[model samples]
Target: MSSCAKADASSSPALEKAALLGREFSLAWLRAAGVSDPEVAVLFDQVILIPAAQHASARFADPSLPRKIVRTIPWSRARDHHLVLAEAAKQQRLAAEVVAEHFEAAHRFDLARAQWMKAGETSCHAGDYKKALRLISRALAIWPWDEAADDRARVLREMARCATNARLTDEARKAWEELADHARDTGKHDLRADALHQLAILSADPVRAGELLAEASKLATRELGPEEAFRHGLAHVDLLVNRVRVAAAKLAFVAVEEAALKSKNPALQSEMLGWKALIAAMAGEAGDATRFVEEGMQIAITHQLPEQVAFAYKRRANIADYAGQYSLEKHSHNVAIRYCRESQTGEEIVCMGCLSYACFRTGDWKEALDTAREVLGQPDLHPGLRAIAGGVRGMIAAFRGEKASAFRHLDEAIRLQRAEGMVGMEFLTLWALAYWHDCQGEGAKACAIYDEIRTLWRESDDLHDSIPGLLFAGAHYADHGRAVQLADCIDIIGEILRKNDLPEARATLLALGAEQARLEGDHEACDKALREAAALQIKAGLPLEQLWIESRHPRAEDHKGVIALATKLGTKPLLARLKGEDCGDSASGLTPRQCEVLSFLATGLTSKEIGDRMGLSTRTVEMHVSRIFERLNCRTRPEAVALAQARGWIKLP
Candidate 1:
């Protein structure tokens, strides 16, 4: 056995038995410590029993021990029944008030009031709101005039905050209003401002909320503290963002950033950086957004603010998504979710939605669908989230060939987004619906919606997604006789890619250029585009694009090359088809005669000169030229040449 076990065994039975006898244990303890009987009675009454009653729960599981000892008390403090009242207070505070009332009936006002206040504070701390409110109100009825007035104010503030935490909003508001009046009457501007701030957070009307914040901010000047000034500045910025006062918001945010930076407060700086990141994201300034988010993340980590770290991660994820860095987007989302607050369900749901979209971009359809459904199943989900979830579901449905279901869900999403006044979500829903329609071969109908989407993009200046928009427009616009407009859109896409230095987007753009070349019957330009795009995709480990370029290889001479690429890419069925005895899957949508004209055009040969070589009339050659233009959906020679090259019909020198 251990030392404790040995000590227990060797200890005297009589000495141990003293602990079981209530009054004997107390008297023995007093005698052993050399206290006189009269002094023992008085000390037990005033010093020992009162504190023992307060601390009994911490010291023993059996309340009977303390209660039994209390019954044997032969003395009292200011009153005789003090231990009885303490015993009652320990059992149930409200029942103890009867003991206090009895003391009150004997006119011992101080002792009675102390018991009532103790019961109230204890109940309040323990979160028994109803009992706390009742007891605290009763305690307040007998105010101590000799005590400082500040004590009363402090108690009233506690009552107010307790009601607030308990979600009795109206009661909290009333209490705060009373406190505000008292503070104003007493010339306490700080307390008045605090009351107004609480009222602002709870106000239902945006106008009233703004008014309250304004009132509070005027009262809480820079003299308060850097932390308070930072909070007020952020609130002012929020009001500006809500009212769409972008310039004013930016101007207000600068002041906050300067304050935090100068104050050397990492926590405050992190918060300001997060706000800056949000503004940059809204404006489609991806690089700026990324820089701000990263700075915030570093600050949050250095300062050990876990929640701020989470917000920083979320901001980076949003910027990565806007920049089309899908892998980075997913990673940032995971990190954000790892550190997010348990009660911040809405933020978690937003992270989930971002992760799902990231999966979709990286070609993980199954995980994307599952995550999207998880977003939909969240309780108390915002309608803005429903709009986003519906977009994901609609895209998945379209990919699986359920066009009607795709349209139904997307239309409903658009409706909800409009109802919620979520302009950003509304724009995305409309874009998704239009893209789906075009994917279903209704390019004409899709073009009608694209006009609005184009306008939205222009107004929002979100040019990062403009590449996909360019591709969609090229497919639909050329046939609709908007060839000049289509060319201009592609030019803009090229400029954006160059300015942004996005090499990943460059491959997709070059692939699109190949499509335009193929349309212009420039087979060589088309072959050049295919080779460059395939090479870029290969370097990026983008197997899907390499497989696509192999399947659509533009020349007979490039057949073995396509087969070799497929083999290198580990693409089984595609390689098998390319190497098969009957390689009929290599068929182009263009006819043999059109291919011949396209090849001649790629050689810089005029149609009339080609007629002399083929022994056909110039008029017949002109007829073929018109027919080729119609077939390839190109208006100009350059466009026809570019589209044909993208389709892989022409061989490059």
Candidate 2:
């Protein structure tokens, strides 16, 4: 409250007449700016004064000088008019009172409004949003006699626009709330619903946001129709769908879809289908996801909205993210970016988040850093987004060997995620932090973090992401002491893997089982598990896993050929412990399968024929032969056969 604005009570009475003259001039000026007498008369009606016919005609012909006002006229609208004139006087560097009188008598109100609004717009364009906001407020408060007294919602909405440009979210939210109240009081359901929709988006609390959106939907349906109802509820449905509240999202989606179908709105229908695909993709229902995504895109092509096209592309990106195809994900995000608007901050931030994750996975560190920093740079970002950005920075920091920076970023992510009740992200951040701790050699700390999430992992929720995280934790848990924990890990994860037919998890489980058996001194069991896991990994055709499994078993790395191959593959960290190791078969207790493979190899059977005979893939057969060579400390099949015969480990026919 500026002192100048607060001291309105003690102004001299003569200032009042200046205001009266200003209002009469404003209405006359409005007529000259394309407003007709009928429009003015109908809107103003009886209570408010209209310019007298003869005087209005006279003023139109030849405007009187502002010196005509010498008597006081007492009215708030009049005082407000004078205030506007005083500012206008200062614009021309004239005496305030003299210009105020001239403004009331001869100056054009239309041009004054245009000039003030243009000044505010220029300030906004220059990024001086605070000054723009203040200037815009000053413009809006400049009262004229022909005011739209019943249309305060529009006024409040304009004020909210100013606050938004200034990045004053709290002010904008309050303005929208007030606007909603005003519209409701005036029985304007459409305006009220729109205001509520804006308020829902501005709210930080998810529960509050959902409530506000729901209210808007209900109000629209009750006062308008199903079409408007869905329009108001669309954002809420998207929010729930993306956040993984499956049941709630499905309910809202169903309602919106039904409304879209009933109203025959292709654009809304297309958007609804896009959301369906996104939800299905998040749930890992790839067939359903793909079908819905295609249907949505075809419909979007027929629609006028660029946003719907962007929605369809974003769903495709989500599917790619789930499939671990980072390149495809990036491509989809780029396409989506083209259709997004400058005002679409939330949508832009989400695409950036996904792009950052894809870049991180594909080892494009520079882009990852750029995208994460871009999200963090957004004005008035949500806490969950903050946590997401911090977590990404942590991973990049760790990769760059900045240990302290990594811990700082990850710790903040974990803390904010937990505080915001972002349960899924909290779990993942904790999982990532544990891996970072292990990488920094804080093994016990890593194990403790695993202890925190092990039970949650067992719940079979979000398994696509949680399974890998838990697998990492399970491996670290084994390092702390696995004899007791191995059975539990195997039992829980094995059942889930089998149910889902997840071969990768199954292979990794087998590898962990091998380590567990070795820890328990069951060398035979250990060798059997390793052999099966290696065969599976080879069938899966993942070179990284093959090298990783070899790293775990030093005997498997004994072959100079494999070491050279691993070196070529840039697997130095996994192969680091392989150097200066014993090349004896002391730990690998060969089983009957290995013996059978040895006999097959001795008979000069190729990998394909060996696989045909043994009911395995050629790659699996190759893996078995490689294991045989490793266990026998040989570099070739013939060498392995000769070593086995010399040791009398196998009998030849």
Candidate 3:
């Protein structure tokens, strides 16, 4: 018989005990000899050492082994080791039952504190804050008097704080409160400081929040040294920045400016300084805003925060756009786009929306559309951000004369903004909707929307604001022969322009004069005023407005002026519109299919019904309509049809 059988045969109690102790020693030797744990355990259990062998295997298979040792063991013995019996149960190995039995025995002898601590760490790593808390609580319960228990509890509380920081919902606020209670109970200075900081952030009362953060920062400095204090101070600065941003969006410029100036931290100071520049610009202090923004840009660049740098550039771009510095605006927007795209944050979406608007202002409608499409395509985009993207897309489509598509995007944007309770965007959306109506030749509807926007602005005490809405409304009144109303609107816009010392005010005045002259049938005055407007439009590189003026006159002087400007600008859309060609056709010329589509549009068919007749998708019909609008010097379906009728290209049925 084997040595094992001989050992079992001598079954005296002392001898059996000796045999069991020997088997245990032999297994240790085997483990040191590089035999796998599962194989060695199996070999020992199969040996004929009777109760000695069994007892030896039981001790060897205890799951209470150190983690380092358990981690290296083979799959079979992992099951036999009672330590990971729950995990072993998941395996389908033949030794699963034996492993489970060993696991049950080992669990009875296992320290709950050790298991809870291990589970807490694993859950924290996996971002399961709730599970981590549960495990830490278990550990605390098992060893309530231990220092290690307090440490584990503190770590779990910190994890909960991090999860709460992700979303500032009521549930997160409650979680933060619970974490603070735990921190205070444990008397861990670092944990207490962290809880205090989080409580400040979650506080709805801004004054109280700031006070709490200040105290937390001081406490952290006293307890955890300067580095921890500075980190906490950074959080305080971020909260202030958020509050300032909210104020800015509400047009509470004074509040934003004050808050920014009050921030003591260098980075926070730089950010607030930038916000001051933005508010100044919005308030029509262009020169001061521009100078301040230049300084802010330098500071942002020095600080090396890509988000701040992008924000500064975007603010500069807005200032430039307002001042009619098209080239400078384009440069600023390009820089903003670069910095925003490089940063891995949600702020990039805001930059993209600004860039899209800049592209639209520069008459790069295709670039604007492409950029807006990219922003809207992001899955994690905020609802407010997506609404802005849609608004930009609507503007691009409107500029391209795709009325249906423009309205579709604008409607979607309005829906999103309303859903988000974004009241600040309401006036802007109304302006866009008004412009869409104007494109479709529904002058009355456009004027009504403009009136509503004016009422909103007046009620909000923003009547003196130099928003683009004033310009659009003024132009619309001028177009419709409301000369007196137009003059009043012009005076309001002119006062704002004069206050800001904007050179473009001259062009707007000249346009208003020309419109009044045309209504009065004074060709000479109209011609002189229009000539001055054209000069300013050319100087400012505003081809869209220049094209509009020339399209109305179409005389030698007007046509020549437009062609020269388009040639100098190298703007394809302007050139095509001036030449009475299809905007969608490449320089190579229109295809036969394009001609057929244009013919159908000239007959006044909507794109949707046309798609059904042609057995094409509505998208394809939209593409053809876009092309037709571009070539025909028309910005709407009715205009295209009218132009076609005037040209005798199609009969009005």
Considering every candidate listed, which one attains the maximal TM-score? Answer: 2
- Candidate no. 3 TM-score: 0.52
Report the C-alpha lDDT of model 3 over 1-653, residue by residue, as the tens digit.
55434334533232222222333333332233243555443444544322335443333333222233434445554433434433333242313233333344444323445545566666667777666656555554444434554555554454455445344245455555665666667676787787778677566575677677766766665667545665665555444433333332333333333444454445555666666675566556777878887787787778787777887888788778667676788788787878877886556667777677667656676777788899889976887778877887876565555667879998998787655544445556777788677555456788888777666554342322234465567656655546677777667656656655554556666776676676677868977887777677667666666665554442433476667756554544335546655423332124546655666776667778778878888899888778766554347776666544422233455
TM-score of each prediction: 0.50, 0.59, 0.52
Model 1 ranges off by over 4 Å: 1-252, 255-266, 278-291, 341-346, 416-428, 479-481, 534-653
**lDDT (Cα, tens digit) per residue for candidate 1, span 311-377:** 8888788777656576888899888877774435447777887687677556566777798899999
Ten contiguous residues minimizing lDDT sum, candidate 1: 11-20
Ranking by lDDT: 2, 1, 3
Per lDDT, the best of the predicted structures is 2
Lowest lDDT sum, 10 consecutive residues, model 2, at 57-66
In Å, residue 269's CA in model 1 sits off its true spot by 2.1
After superposing candidate 3, which stretches have Cα over 4 Å from the reference?
1-264, 300-311, 340-346, 417-429, 459-468, 478-484, 552-557, 560-653
lDDT of each: 0.61, 0.62, 0.58
Q: What TM-score does structure 1 among the candidates reach? A: 0.50
At residue 333, what lDDT does model 3 achieve? 77
Which scores higher on TM-score, 1 or 2? 2
Which of the two candidates, 1 or 2, achieves a greater lDDT against the reference?
Answer: 2
